[model samples]
Target: MGVMYRPPNSGQDQGHKMHHKIESACQKGKVTVIMGDFNMQVDWVNNAASGPKEREFIECLQEGVLEQLVMEPTREQAILDLVLCNEPDLIKDLKVREHFGGSDHNVVEFNLQFERKKVESDVKVLQLNKGNYRGMREELMKIDWEQSLVGKTVEQQWQEFLGVIEDTVQRFIPKKRKVIRGEIRQPWLTKEVGECIKAKEKAYNVAKSSGKSEDWEGYKNKPRITKREIRKERINYEGRLASNIRNDSKSFFKYIKNKREAKVDIGPLQNDAGNLVMGDQEIAEELNKYFASVFTVENMSNMPTIQESQGAESNMVAITKEKVLEKLRGLKIGKSLL
Candidate 1:
């Protein structure tokens, strides 16, 4: 069974083609059932006031030989609901059940003697040899350490480590197997961290202004500044300034607390049971575990080299074969026949 929402402005020919495709798919002994809010009336038996669009829709249904499964006439004078079947003969009974009372549309039900298709067994192919890691030491030695570490801070290095783990499971795991994953390269962090740093700097500036004001007031009534007094005031101001800087730095670090948390959140070292009670902490820990598992050197080891090759090949293909076929179909060949 398949369902779709077709818009009113989809055009007549397109609508006809959609019906044809469903019919063709069904005729291939698929026993397919297509139902949806078609957004058009198939008949005026229930709906007395019919427009050209509704009339056209009814004509199309007749042309396609779509069996109307529902016999109950709706109070709302629009044939927006539909049930189409390729193997109408297989259906023992069909009727529109009363609104179980919540939805605007009526529910249609059908009974059939149909056998469920057997699940196909998938053959697993082993591709990678465990022996490949024997040469991993050589590959690791060849990698440019300076190049890889460039632009990476302590925090970024930790994040990159987590990213490697997440990429592995997503890329290698079978689709049917359920697993949690995290998006590693979050661009939003750049903006979030930048804003946090700016806020911290602003607070530091405010604190500096307040300390300067205090110094100015203390010296306002003095006739001349003594060397000892000058040194003392300078020391006092510097101490206050240092304190402000420390506080600001602490706040900035706190803003990136999640990233710091992620660094220690995975594998045997994880503190999941303790962290789970704290929602934000738990999210950070989960993200850390996910990233740690996928974004490893082992998973993305050949990504840089493969991406370069694929990107170059993709650029060389002119217009792409897909686009060319689309252009060919767009040119009208038989408008008169329609």
Candidate 2:
């Protein structure tokens, strides 16, 4: 199903008509994929706080057992364009690309993987912090490194060192095999916001059952306030993170990259002769040749070698438990590095 030009001021009557069509289609029980410019935010996070059009759409989808796959915004900080499926479990790698040209909608892409035919792929997983690092260090301290190497040949010593390390690692850092699944969720979502959403849902139910003017008013006003609170919570959470960028630059940049999905890899390059260089080898050769021609060195015959300072002292400090704890405290809980 495709929708377009659903204006912002579209009345509830028009929304109902659209919802009826979708609901009718869903009642057929065929695998349904609804996509295009919805021009509506479904408010999936705070289920009850959606606008009238979105509310109707959500209700229709819920009745049809449909789930929206695209979470990120498709327009200016709003998920206007949507990709919804009745069987979300069958959908894999659902992604929303940046908007194309001047269109307000983004390019939505996904893969269909049948659950019945899904081949289980083994994944090696290990949690580094799950191991007793102190115990491992203590065990290593008991070993006589000098004596272990003294009477052995170079190859024998290498093999012995490798064996000891491998044994220790296997004993401490155990690996588990598991099957890959779906995408992970954002960490900043809070229980407080969730409770507020539930309250809004309750209010909506009260209004629907009672059908009183005051009850409807309360329902309308409560969700608006709850949405505002949710926005404020999100802003404050991100504000605190903005302050940590300088200290934890690696994590900060990683967070930005994930949020924006900003990995760029322009494959293949065309040379000046208009011949396309396809592979890495050909591309590298072309780049090297271009650079060699453009680069210049004055008085190359009398170039002098630069020497490093002999008196430089390293300012390296030992990583203590306190330092590690402080670092952990600085990072937001549940936030992943990737």
TM-score of each: 0.31, 0.45
Candidate 2 lowest-lDDT run of ten: 97-106
Model 1 poorest 10 in a row by lDDT: 219-228
| Stretches of model 2 off by over 4 angstroms after superposition | 1-32, 35-116, 123-183, 302-338
Model 2, position 109, has a per-residue lDDT of: 74
lDDT of 2: 0.74
- Report RMSD for candidate 2: 13.9
lDDT of 1 at 151: 94
Model 2, 112-177: lDDT tens per residue? 776477666677777676887888999999999998899888769988999999899888887777
> Which segments of model 1 are wrong by more than 4 Å?
8-17, 26-29, 44-52, 116-338
33, model 2: CA deviation in Å? 3.2
Q: What are the lDDT figures for the candidates, one per model?
A: 0.55, 0.74
